[model samples]
Target: MTFTLGPRAISAGYQLAAFDQIGSTNAEALARARDGERGPKWFVTTEQTAGRGRRQRAWVMPRGNLASSILEVMDVSPAVAATLGFAAGLSLESALQKLAVEANMRRAEPLKFALKWPNDVLAERQKLTGILLEAEAVAGNRLAVVVGIGTNVVAAPEGTPTPATSLAALGVHVGAEELFKGLAEAWVEFRGIWDNGRGFAGIRKAWLDRAFGVGEPVAIRTGTATIEGTFDTIDETGCLIVRTAEGKRMPITAGEVYFGTAASLGAT
Candidate 1:
């Protein structure tokens, strides 16, 4: 159950639990967090059989891939939980950057990837990873939050709603045991940025750095009526800012973004 981290993570004292299979890491992590079993001091799971992402979507993960969840209790307002996924997105983006370099993935000219608002990682516009945050009301005074992440280290199943890619496809052969610890460590750095009333200015800055569609015309579906707008930027709370087709600046809390491109379609 215990997986060893590479030398890079050892100095940081990251411990990971590896699983051959599981229904969902986020679900398991949430249950554990509710039991007082999470925080910056602990990291869980190296791989999951059935991972999960936002809105209960499937987080398809293959063996030897990055599939784990970080459990933490936050002071965030549940009303804004939809936006908090951006923090996790920022963290994973940094981790992937490190992975890409360590594996010498850049030599292959892999398509540059970026974070899609809400919760997905893209490679050349196709999804390479996704984040899932689950929370539950706890007794007395605490809420349980689990940040589950899934990345394609080897491959994702075909016939998924959108296209997918793996590290291997980009010339990076990242093994599960070798990658989880670094991912855990990256969360620690990001959690620090999230805490301390800093809001998401830093996360937004980094997100915007690798973000796609900042100046492109796009549409976000709110279900009742679609909002067509031009992509603007991210705000302090990590919410996406868009200029409505009417030229009004709008902060979108929730929706599926459509950018008329393959890499932007993202998740199901």
Candidate 2:
């Protein structure tokens, strides 16, 4: 299937570049940004040979999966630009909801699809999508950020760190192109809501509403130390707020979060 940006995405100043195969969409996008390609563009590929998730973890990108990256040059600082991960996560959640509704496969319970802390989208507590955000400094204090997203549409990798599932595994027969269409359109809407990180309060609220393990026990691993606490709310800067057993609220800026006794860990 040919990948194309929807009218909504184009109207919102998004350009599309589709590839049959690539080493890494995020890498290509960043390379282009460094060469003075200041674009709000989408770098999409059917297959990625060298894709990576957060913390340099290997990202399995099968041929039928969705491997795409959004590159935007922003005036915001790198710290502020990092918040776009929340926007991307919320966008993916919205896109999945739309796909489920279109297939008439809505879950009876509310959280059939939910967002994990930092950057994962889960379907029934199993990971369905992963998000990665990378940023580079440009001339004159401008920063360029690339939001990379990968979704398991037809198949999920086996023996992953966390339990994995796909749309096909869930009995929803959707193609990567179809999913990307929804994702592109939904991204435009969510970007508008984000307003370049100025409107983060609404994004934070929406993300928490669909959060997978809020108010539940979670274990967060940051390097050598592991901290177990109750999953609390996210702060204004999009940090995960974990309330430890000692009644202290610790805001985690980066870590691997595991929920509900899941020993497996994934990057956040």
Candidate 3:
């Protein structure tokens, strides 16, 4: 099946650059931005040979999986641009939920999809998708930002920090092409609400509604130390708010989060 942009995305003036294979969609998107391609366009593929997750961790996408990145050139600061990731999470979660319903699997036994703080989508507490945001300065003080989303459609990597799952493993049985179609349209809706950071308040609220592990015990590994606390909420600037044991509300800028049993075990 060929990957294509949804009608809504096309109508919204969003473009697509689908590939049969690629080293990294995010890398390609950024390169285009450097070459003066100022676009709200998507670079997508089914197989990614050299993808990097947060902290330069390898994230190789198998042939059956989906690797997609969207490029946007904006005048917002990188700090404000970072918040766009929240909208990406919301968009992907919305797409997955829509696909689940279309497959008629949710009517009998619903499959829960939740956003993991920062950039991940969890299906039943198992990592199903990983999102990475990268940006570089372009001409006229604008930033070319690429938001990459990779999902396990038919295959999940083994022995990860957090156990991973796939749509096929969960019995959804959808193709990567179909998933991308839904994701493209969903992006249009959520990106509209985001409105380039001016509407982040609404995005934050909706994201929390579909967030995983709020009010649950959490341990965050932030290189220097492990901060253990209960997951509270995300702040206005998109920082993770944790309620420490000492009754202090601590905001974490970035960290590896562990919850439930993993939190108790001090898992990184």
lDDT for 227 (candidate 1)? 74
Candidate 2 regions with alpha-carbon error over 4 angstroms: 105-111, 263-268
What overall lDDT goes with each candidate model? Answer: 0.68, 0.88, 0.93
Q: Taking the tens digit of each residue's C-alpha lDDT, what string does model 3 give over 110-228?
A: 88899999999999789999999999999999999999999999999998888899999888889999999999999999999999899999999999999999999999999989898
* Span of ten consecutive residues with least summed lDDT in model 1: 38-47
lDDT of 3 at 173: 85
lDDT of 1 by residue, 1-268 (tens): 3455555445645445556677677777766666766453334454565665665666667666777776656555665554556777877777777777755544656457798887888877778887776777666566666667787878866776656778787777767655666666676677667663355667667778888778887778776767777889877766678897678999887777877553245443
Per-residue error for 267 in candidate 2, Å, reads: 13
Q: Rank the candidates by lDDT, best first.
A: 3, 2, 1
**lDDT, residue 214, model 3:** 95
Clashing residue pairs in all predictions, respectively, total 1, 0, 0
lDDT, candidate 2, 1-268, per-residue tens: 6898888998888899999999999999999999998889999987999999989998998898999999999899788888889999989888888778745545454448899888999987789999999999987789989999999988888887778899888867888998899899999988999988899999999989988889988888999989888999999999999999999999999988888765334422
Q: List CA RMSD, all candidates.
A: 3.3, 2.1, 1.3
Q: Kindly indicate the candidate among 1 and 2 with the higher TM-score.
A: 2
